[model samples]
Target: MAKYVLRLFDDRIGVKAQGSLPAENRIIFIADGSATVSAGGGAATLAANSAFFSAAETTVTGGAEGAYVLRYELVSVPETEHGMLTGENIFSELLLNASMELEPGDGYLMRCDRVDLPPGGIAYTHTHQGGGIRCLLRGEFHVQTQGKEHVINPGEPWFEAGPDPVLAWAPDHKPGHFSRVMILPRALKGKSSISYVNAEDAGKPKLQRYTIFADEFIAI
Candidate 1:
């Protein structure tokens, strides 16, 4: 099996700030304000709530109003530049770092998507075909997995190992939402990875919705 590390970073850039992201498979999400990202001989201006993917080294410049960016990347080794606050007006905080082991094969797919849960919605116990890192976007929820329970709040990140069963639910008073990036087998492209543990749950009502942002094939 080949080992990889999935990392999530929160970056704050000032109006005059600019920097380069290392050459790797990455998903860049614009959380607030805007940014201009150039990669692979192309440049695009991404507004808040939108995202894009890059497979090569990328240059990023904050917009006139600065920006709050979320970066998710896959690397062979864990990066040391975690909590860096540079005088150049760029600030970064590493939110999640998790290891993933995958069988060497043809190619893989990198998917970035958002999940929305209505108030009191519950995702029955289930497992996925691949692992991923999820960051809560709004409201609050609790996740039960591996005999442990965790309360996730906005801006917090968590990791889920694919084979381990997970059960998540949102509070009755408010809706919950989160965004995630997953590494999966190429065959799963445009497919859902979730599998309910109990066959009966498959017929239950599902109150969650999804929005796909980036789904690209990648070389291992």
Candidate 2:
């Protein structure tokens, strides 16, 4: 298998520039502003919450007012016949293989939102029922899944496997913010997207394993 490379890029442009993708495939998420990405005679204008895939060796040209992008260089993993059910990469702690199958004409539901936290804020442990990708827009965020942790900074991208338990925190020095694009099932149940691991964890101390933030909320 090939190794994956994750990178963060921030571009503030007054004029257009040339670009190219050298990895096998690169997934890009736009964090802010607007930009035009042209390749192979096709062009796409991207804004916040937008994402696109550029194949390897594609020559791209673009211009932007102000934009930050999170790029993931990914290699396709082998199929189940190869004997592996899950994998890990720089993008995520646990990349669990999707456990469900889609039927004919089935469609996926997408939920996009911006989640922000005050300085020294904490998000109680929780889980999402479907997979998603998140990109840090400002400050710093500490993401703990299961027991492993990863720090995500501005312009960086991270992944969520949906079923795994997760906790997010803001470092004491500054406020934190990020955007997410989640893929959920169309027939999903419930009025809320999140499933808190323990309702009791919500009232714990700030330094405890879980705690609630005063200004905590998600904008969908």
Candidate 3:
């Protein structure tokens, strides 16, 4: 399993996980703030623009403030099937493409595809079927799921399933925008998108769609 952590950078706003970089494959970079990461056999202090990869025997702890990190787990991305798109029109442009299985069985499994939405662009709800994670890379979307309505802004994500299937409308989704969602079977065992019961108090969601599926993602 690969662990994803967003060591708080700022007290208020969420500064992104630096991204769920990997421990084995992660860069272990301290972008803005400062922090201490356990390595080899002692503590190494990382400051802004400072990066290292010797935290094999250590864990990261916040200092006076916090640190932003981008983690990439070799076991997670390399083992699991993944596809990505970049630039203005990523999904629609088909920047990158791949296919995978959501479960052991072949049937009842969806293609697990990703597509981009242009401003005022609308993807039929039929395309939103199957279970996956949706991340608002940029801009916002009028997201309505399971009788609940809300706005998914940039740097935010949402998960959907049958019945209460999710629906997103860019009726107001801004431009130069991008969002990505990873589709997976909720039936899959192991680290899931299940949020902590006390996430609300913690002030951050359990899953980071664009990068990390969860702090501790399961492996096959």
Candidate 4:
């Protein structure tokens, strides 16, 4: 079975659509603008800095013209296959949109973590052992990765390739909060899944990092 499936929806103003999820634990990230998402007579608005899991099929109505949503269809791997499987891709279809690539992997362990920061808090420069997506929930965060800076506000989502060093900072006056899902490998399966890099070490060559193969990603 495939590890996960990803689809990007770019909806114009007044667009309404109905769709069903392949799995119950699908994740929906709002990359831009707002949308009214309803299912089974219940509805919620997801915009910048917001995300939610759908345990069933859902209907989505675009909030305005030119809005987009990133949908992740997550599937869990058997622990026996990967030593102990844990986290959760769309690679090609996303190429025209986001600046991320799906890493090579035979299978993946899906893990999600809720992160919170205090005013003036900094996550420091770090890297993940696996690739995944992050969604900002509240407050403000400044994320610098791969030499580009992104201000992740509420309802906005970002992706990391797991090997690149990243710097995240909360504003000096307020706090920051977000959640991330990591799609990691079972090799060295018991490791913490995260690595930290110091400012001074960032410029150094030959920093130790794992390898991800091109064959592991899905071809368009």
Cα lDDT tens digits for candidate 2, 1-220: 1322222233332234444544333445555555566544667877755666554344333345544444433333332122111212111122222223322233434445567787898888989876666667789999999789999887667778788899889999977787665545565522346777898975665442211111111111
- Candidate 4, residue 105: Cα displacement in angstroms equals 7.6
lDDT (0-100) at residue 49 of candidate 1?
A: 80
Could you tell me every candidate's TM-score relative to the true structure? 0.93, 0.55, 0.35, 0.51
Q: Candidate 4: TM-score?
A: 0.51
- Among these predictions, the greatest lDDT belongs to 1
Candidate with maximal TM-score: 1
Cα lDDT, all candidates: 0.87, 0.53, 0.38, 0.54
TM-score-best of 2 and 4: 2
Task: Please give the TM-score that candidate 1 achieves against the real structure.
Answer: 0.93
For residues 154-194, write the lDDT of model 4, one tens digit per residue. Answer: 75667777888998788898777766655566553445676
Off by over 4 Å in 3: 1-114, 127-129, 179-219
Ranking by lDDT: 1, 4, 2, 3
Question: 9-100, model 3: which lDDT tens digit per residue?
Answer: 11111222111212332234444466666655666777754544431433555556555433222222344423111222112111222233
Question: What C-alpha lDDT, on a 0 to 100 scale, does residue 204 get in candidate 4?
Answer: 43
lDDT of 3: 0.38
Backbone clashes for every candidate come to 0, 0, 11, 13
| lDDT tens digits, residue span 1-220, model 1 | 8777898998998895888876778999887899899999999998888888998878888998888888899876445434233448898888988998866555789999989999999999999988999998889989999899999999999999889999999999978898899998888989999999999999999999999999899876
Q: At residue 40, give the lDDT of candidate 3.
A: 55
As for model 2, its CA RMSD to the true structure in angstroms is: 10.2
